[model samples]
Structures are given as structure tokens and as C-alpha cells.
Target chain A: DAGVTQSPTHLIKTRGQQVTLRCSPKSGHDTVSWYQQALGQGPQFIFQYYEEEERQRGNFPDRFSGHQFPNYSSELNVNALLLGDSALYLCASKINGGYEQYFGPGTRLTVT
Target chain B: AQSVAQPEDQVNVAEGNPLTVKCTYSVSGNPYLFWYVQYPNRGLQFLLKYITGDNLVKGSYGFEAEFNKSQTSFHLKKPSALVSDSALYFCAVPRAGSYQLTFGKGTKLSVIP
Candidate 1:
């Protein structure tokens, strides 16, 4: 089975610009979560989406938002991006209510 | 607040030697523990987890982790290290009933041939 997939493997955007990153959950998974990994650091939770609604969120600013579609795909949107927003965006998915999350390759966003 | 700490930033081991990467956690309730590995330019790959039951959990690539509730530690171990096992390892913990995980900074394992 195909695993989780993300779009736009790499991108470069200017500061203050907005960007959208997409993700397709692994086959048979329903819950989607997003994470940010800075260089040389572990991944940090951004937020989680279940049942098409955001269920839990981390300490991230309101600039980071996400949506989970009916087909279990997801999109992460960042507005007014700062240079610090540059990082690898990862999408993880698990079976309905199950805890083990399978991660995608991630989208590398570089804010210049 | 739940958190994880990987005490060592880097670990070196000779091929065929036993290796260990240490981790400790802090959480209010029972914690679910996990270990993941990441190669250069790759996403984190699940290694093993300790949710319930056995304290010693074996996972992919001949890796195992021992969970000690008394110490609130979960250390990953490999009996015979291989050069190919060199990579970055992360330790994470989730609060009871929560899927949101708190991750340690990560440990870089270098196995010399």
C-alpha cells in the first residue's frame, strides 16, 4: 500500500507571503496531524485534525492552520510567514482514533 | 506538561558492539513511549513503542527499547551495532490517552566499522 504522500517537496517563498502545503494520508488512515521540524531538531506538533475538525493544537501561533478533507487528505496553510517559518512540514496519519501515526516524506519550505 | 529528554547529543559505537541511547520523560499520567530513526534527508521512521504490556519492546531493524516506570526512562538498545545503523534517533512520549507526543532533541548514533 502507498504510504503518506506530500506535495511540493521543496519551495521557496519571500517573507510576508502565504503558502499552502498539501498532504495525502496513508491508505486506510483517517486522522491527520501536522508537525514542523527545524534543522537539527526533532519534530514539533502543530495541530491535529479528526472528523474534519481540529481536535488538538500545539503552542503555535494562529498563523498556522490546517484542514482535513473528507478523503483524509490535508492542507497546511501559513500566512504572513517569517523567515523562522522556514522548516520541514510533515504530515502524519493514523487509523480512526488509533495512536500510531505513519509520517510522510514532508514538504521542505524555505522562507527567504 | 509532558516532555522527553535525550541526555546525549551523540553516541559512538564500534561495529558488533552493544549500544545504548538514553532517554527520560516527564508526564503527569501514564506515558506512551516511542523511538524513531531518521536518515539524512528523510522523515522520522518508527522504531518501536511501549504503550502497555511488556516493558521491553522489540521493533524494526533489530532494535529494542526498555521502559522503566520507576525511573521514567526508555532507553533504546541494540546488541550488535552495524555501521549502517548510524543515524539520528528520537525519543518521544505521549500523555495517557493522548496522541500528541513530546519529542527529545534527538541523538546522533555513529557506528564505526
Candidate 2:
């Protein structure tokens, strides 16, 4: 089965602009989580979605939000972007309560 | 709150040499630990996980990690390093009562031939 897939392998936006990133979880996976990875850093948790609702979230600001579709696909929305938001956005998929997670290639966002 | 720590920013070793990437974690209850590798321009890849039992966990690409509860550590190791193993390594911990995973800053491994 294909692993998690993310749209717009790369993106560029200006400060204060809004952007939406998409993700399709691996087949048979019901949970989706998003992370942001800055250069030279491990990924930081953004949020997690399960059953079309956000299950948990991290320390990210309210400017960051997400949605999960009935089909288990997910989208991450970031508004009022800042230069610090420029990083690799990753999508991870797994079954509910499962510990192992599969990841996508990620969307590299650059705020100019 | 759960958190992970990768002490080394970068680890350097020659090919065929053993390599170890140190990691420590803190959580309220039993923790689920994991190791992931990221190649240039790619997202994190799951290398292995420690749920319970068996402190020594082996994973893909001949990688292994030992879970030490007393020390609150889960360090990744490779019996023999390879040039291909040179990449970014991440240590993650899944909170016992939550689904979120707290990650470390990451360690860049460079293996010279």
C-alpha cells in the first residue's frame, strides 16, 4: 500500500498569507497527524485527527488548524504565516492506538 | 507532558565502525519510544519502536535500540555503520495517555568511507 501522500511537494508564500496543505493517509489507516520540521531539527507535533475530528494538539498557535475528511484524508491550514513557519510539513498515518506511524515525503513551505 | 532529548547535534564515524545515537525521554507514565531516520529532503521514516518487553529492539537497515527504563533512555545503535546510514536521526516518545509524540531536536550522522 502507498504510504501517506502530501500535496504540493513545495510551496512559497509571503508573510501574512494563508496556505493549506493536504495529506492522504496510508490505506486502512484511520488516524492522521501533522508535524513541522525546521531545518536541522526533528519534527514538532502540530495536531492529530481521527474520525473527522481533531483528537489532540501540540503547542502550536491557533493560526494553525487542521481537518480530517470522512475518507481519512487530512489538511493542515496555517494563517498569518511568519518566516519561522518556513519548514517541512509532514503527515503521518497510523491506526487508532497504534504506536508505529508511516510518514509522507512532506511539503516544504518557504515564507518569503 | 512528554519530551525527548537527543544530546548530540552530529555524530561522525568511519564506515564499518559501530555507531550510537543517544536519546533520553521524560513522561508521566510508561512511555512508547521510537526512532526515525530522515534522508535529505525527505520526511521522517520509522526505524523502530519500543512498546514493552525486550529492551533490545532491532529494526530496518540493521539498526537497533535498547530501552533502559531506569535511565529513561532509548539509544539507537548500529553494529556496523555504512555511508548510506548518514542522515538525520530523531528520537520520539508517545505519551502514555495521549496520541501525540514529542520529538527531540535530531542528530545528524555522517559516516565517512
TM-scores for all candidates: the values are 0.96, 0.96
Local distance difference test scores for all models: 0.92, 0.93
Q: Write the residue-wise lDDT of candidate 2 on A1-112 in tens digits.
A: 7888999999999999999999999999999999998887778889999999998988899999999999999999999999999999999999998888899999999999
Deviating ranges (above 4 Å) for candidate 2: none
Ten-residue region with minimum lDDT total, candidate 2 chain A? A37-46
Kindly report which residue pairs in candidate 1 clash with one another: none
lDDT of 2: 0.93
Q: Candidate 1: list runs displaced more than 4 Å.
A: B95-97
Please compute and give the TM-score of the first chain of candidate 1 against the native first chain.
0.98
- RMSD values, in order shown: 1.2, 1.2
Pairs of residues at least 3 apart in sequence or in different chains that clash in candidate 2: none
Tens-digit per-residue lDDT, A15-100, candidate 1: 99999999999898999999999988999999999899999998899999999999989999999999999999989999866668
Error of 1 at A3 (Å): 0.5
